[model samples]
Target: MNNENSKLTISRIIQAPRSTVWKAWSEKEHFEKWWIPEPITCKVVKMDMTPGGGFETLMSENGEEFQPHVEGCFLEIVPLERIVFTTVLTEGWKPNDPWLSMTAIITMEDASSGTKYTAEALHKNPEDSNKHLEMGFEEGWGTTIDQLEKLIMKLA
Candidate 1:
């Protein structure tokens, strides 16, 4: 694992195939099912799983008032391998002034009996990285990943 001054990495070995995990991310319905933690529902406003494509989503506690959770662009996409996205740009590569500019790299590799999933959230500065850490990045991401595993396992 590479450690950076402005980056956070979380990894786990999910007991599912790489393709299954990829499907959970690529499919809008599947993604929405586990993108957010329990009690918080996710609504995919727009999602294009391609480079420079939009990846927008909303989250709501009660299913009425959906608040913007992610408004970003896909930086890279490799089927069943990796996904990279950034909040510095919107769909079609349009620049956006975000409170904090960050890129997330999600990778999946074949494991002995499942898939090795990893996510690295990289920030432009240490302050922003620390802020995210303080904002429960680990707990939030961990819970989402756990939900993803459950969803995939059920589908499998």
Candidate 2:
């Protein structure tokens, strides 16, 4: 159930229960523990997990902070199953460019004694998708998922 041309999608099978993985994503405290890699701390500036709510995260590594990534309103949220939110990077959700917004859909499914996590990012055009790929998205996202797996396993 994936299309290569339908934006960007990353899938992983995490060895954890659905509830635990869902909590790791929905809870801000649990989210910070695995959202970034080692030596880099991730903090949620603001997270309101609901439709029309904005979520912001700040990534700091070696005491140096990179520009925070902000996602604007959630278009859809299905508890323990899926989250569809719009990605808009701006201070306090205000779009400076007014032309950069992507729809990100994260889905969770029950697998064989584990959970399937799928992150699908729908960009406005092919250029945006190419940009994400050029940004070492595979390695970056793989590391994030690896971090998540380690954290969730500790909980289990």
lDDT of each prediction vs. the true structure? 0.94, 0.78
TM-score to native of every candidate shown: 0.96, 0.85
Best by lDDT: 1
Candidate 2, pairs of clashing residues: none
Q: Encode model 2's per-residue lDDT on 2-114: one tens digit a residue.
A: 33554878899999988988988899999988887767888888777777677777778765665565546666789999988776643344553434457789999999969
* Candidate 1 residue lDDT tens string, 1-156: 334889999999999999999999999999999999989999998889989999999999998999988899999999999999999999999998777689999999999989999999999888889999999999999999999999999988
In model 1, the worst 10-residue window by lDDT is 1-10
Candidate 1 residue 134 Cα shift, in angstroms, is: 0.1
Best by TM-score: 1
**Residue 88 lDDT, candidate 1, scale 0-100:** 93
Q: Give the lDDT of residue 47 in candidate 1.
A: 89
